[model samples]
Target: MSTDRTDCLFCRIVAGDVPATVVATTDRAVAFRDIDPRAPLHVLVVPREHHPDVVALAAADPALLADVVALGRQVAEAEAGGQFRLVFNTGPEAGQSVEHVHGHVLGGTRLGWSPG
Candidate 1:
């Protein structure tokens, strides 16, 4: 897709160099199970191409940002049985482990404000 070794773990997953419990995959995105899930239905929706973060994506192509959001909602509604929350851990301070941009879809139960 994009250049390899984007200094992002999610990039590796997208490249298939790393293993992940993929839930769904598209030409532009990939949905996979979160390793450290905060809820019973926790999935990470990541773009096949690496973007530094949301801000970068917005500046590059705003419409692309919508794709990630839409896909996250689709995955959440489908897999969580109806409703869920979408989360994007943008930076290190926000608990983003991987540099590649991603949205976390959490549901399947009443998830509290603080992650469990």
Candidate 2:
């Protein structure tokens, strides 16, 4: 596990300090049920280590980024039966409410181009 931020909600979840409907967990990351799901099979895959966003994570190690994405694919296949979308919100303007980087797996229905 990586160093955690005391105030990060995803960090808390990673530490088991907070409860979440975790769908899958790996040495490097975790996938949990989204509190506010947009699709029938919506989940959030976050790294155990905190990164401000995906770009930051990518800068550190492409492999770790790949791991997180691979986890997202697994979540999608299990939850959506192989058809899904992977979305990453890079900043507040992009709709990322949490500071921790995460990959969203949404499917089981058609996802629109605009989240609106």
Candidate 3:
């Protein structure tokens, strides 16, 4: 429970500075519901430590990066339909609102191929 990012949205959510419907949490990570859900079941999984973005994860720790992906898959499999789409929007063009690194687990319906 560190308030590393005073401006990062995910940091705020994890620190209880911002309210969110948390789904799951671990020693190093936390998963919560996205306010403006792009899909029926939209869960945002973020590391407890502040990571600028996915690129940061690639350079910081390979094992941590893998754990994030593995967790996403686990959440997807546990969904009602046992299927989900994982998304990591990079920059502004990619629709990344918060700079903090996070993965979006979208499920509960058929997802289209195009971006939203």
What's each prediction's TM-score? 0.89, 0.94, 0.89
Query: What residue pairs are clashing in model 1?
Result: none
RMSD of each: 2.0, 1.4, 2.1
lDDT of all the models against the reference? 0.82, 0.90, 0.82
Best candidate according to TM-score? 2
Question: How do the candidates rank by lDDT, highest first?
Answer: 2, 3, 1
lDDT of 1 by residue, 1-116 (tens): 25476467888888888899998877778899999887999999887777877887778767777888788888887878768998887789888777878888899998778852
Q: Which scores higher on lDDT, 2 or 3?
A: 2
- Each candidate's number of clashing pairs is 0, 0, 0
Q: In model 3, how large is the Cα lDDT of residue 79?
A: 71
Pairs in steric clash, model 2: none
| Tens digit per residue, CA lDDT, model 2, 1-116 | 35568899999999999999999989999999999988999899999988889999999877889999999999888878889999999889899999899999999997789864
Give the lDDT of residue 34 in candidate 1. Answer: 92
Q: Across residues 1-116, which tens digit of lDDT does each residue of candidate 3 receive?
A: 24488888888888999899988777777888888987888998888888878998779876777877777777777773668888998998898888888999999999889856
Q: Which is better, 1 or 3, measured by lDDT?
A: 3
Error of 1 at 96 (Å): 1.3
lDDT of 2 at 69: 92
